[model samples]
Target: MKLTEVQEILAKSSQEDWIVDDESGSFTYKNDLNLHIDRADFDSYREFNEPWATSHPDPHAVSVEYVVKYGSSFVDKHTLVSVDGHRATLPMPKSINDLRVTESDVNFAKIVNIGDRVDEYLKRARLVEVEDNE
Candidate 1:
């Protein structure tokens, strides 16, 4: 499979919300959740503002962490969802390197699995990208 084909599949499956950032050389999906994918390496995290502490007048206590939660803050603290193990490397054809299509690109099925993982992550995060009909 070619890189372009993979990009097209992700774009369609993600409702065109997944965009390729040429400068970063990675695919970025930003909605309520923010995801950055570089080759088989990807990072998923959410950003939100934490309530201000009583001692501090500032209310902009921003926090970022994986979407999945584990236990209470005093216990295990928030942890990553077990998406087939943390940072599970999605299968990709060896022909593809750094999101660039090599001359020997093949294995269409593996390329498709990459898209599947992306969709799965979005779903696991309680986010289903859908077209805005309005």
Candidate 2:
């Protein structure tokens, strides 16, 4: 698969939908998978305090948002629901690089393996097992 296709699939597909073909060495997105990462174990995430502040594309933008906007070309939409139903302002691609998509340009599905990466981080940090939500 080409770089663009990998990106497109990732933009719309969830972690559960990643499809890897063994023979052809191609990846695709499908909804049949019954696996997923329930939550991420991270030090912190970035968020914007001043939406109007023009200091280089809102430096306070949520760390994830900053990374997606500047780091990769994921233009699709994703949402999060609040437990308290509070209103907030957040957008994709807060910067040029994010935790998931690190490199400026690469085959997303091929390069990103959230589960393994997260596990490694948690293990190295001596964090306990994060129950897989599968």
Candidate 3:
């Protein structure tokens, strides 16, 4: 997927619950839930079997909330685990220079709004192009 694709998809959706945080260079969308993506870093990696429920009745059944796999110097994959144990893995860009947004990434991230409204918001925030037609 590409950034233009993301913009196009967002533009066509009906939901308007989206946010772009300039301070952190992150975007968030809310439906019944929230999905967030950080533009700056991907350092929040965790082991699948970490003891998240150390004090729970089923300590050994600790849920693996999320994981980040790396290759060489860049992130290779990002996985999200739901409370019910379902998992979804998304391939990441090889480097910052190759960073681009995809539909799956947006869907998995639960991004809601996009298009002209979002562009207008980004414009007001000065985070994207300021031209009227952009």
Candidate 4:
């Protein structure tokens, strides 16, 4: 992606709540969670917050709103149910690298697994064996 495009994504992501994704298809609360920690652990997250805040300054602090808008072609519209009972159209990136198509872009359509909740994805079954002697 072009520097401009990356800057746009960074701006938009900074505005909203962000979720972190592991390259291996897992999701987590921390951006680098998959690198050196357990997927279920978040105790260290707070330890990094202050340092992160100091190290990474907000781009918007410098009056850089232009860095957040993207071309129409890069975004996809999704209908979400609002609390007011109205369907709201939300703009989402069609691809991870929506600003520029890349070989590393994940094909969300193939992995979304719609209608399946994370609990359902985590459910498992155990097998039991019986012996005739018993």
Clashing pairs in 3: 10-114, 11-114, 11-115
lDDT: worst 10-residue window of model 2: 80-89
Error of 4 at 74 (Å): 4.2
What is the number of backbone collisions in each predicted candidate, taken in the order shown?
Answer: 0, 18, 3, 0
Give all candidates' CA lDDT scores.
0.29, 0.29, 0.32, 0.21
lDDT (10s digit) by residue, model 1, range 39-70: 32234432222111111233222221222111
- Estimate the TM-score of every prediction: 0.21, 0.25, 0.23, 0.16
Q: What TM-score does prediction 2 earn?
A: 0.25
- Model 1 has an lDDT value of 0.29
Error of 1 at 113 (Å): 11
Residue 105 shift from truth in candidate 3, angstroms: 9.6
Residue 47 CA displacement from its true place in model 4, Å: 45
The alpha-carbon root-mean-square deviation between model 2 and the true structure, to one decimal in Å, is 15.5
Among these predictions, the greatest TM-score belongs to: 2
Candidate scoring better on TM-score of 2 and 4: 2
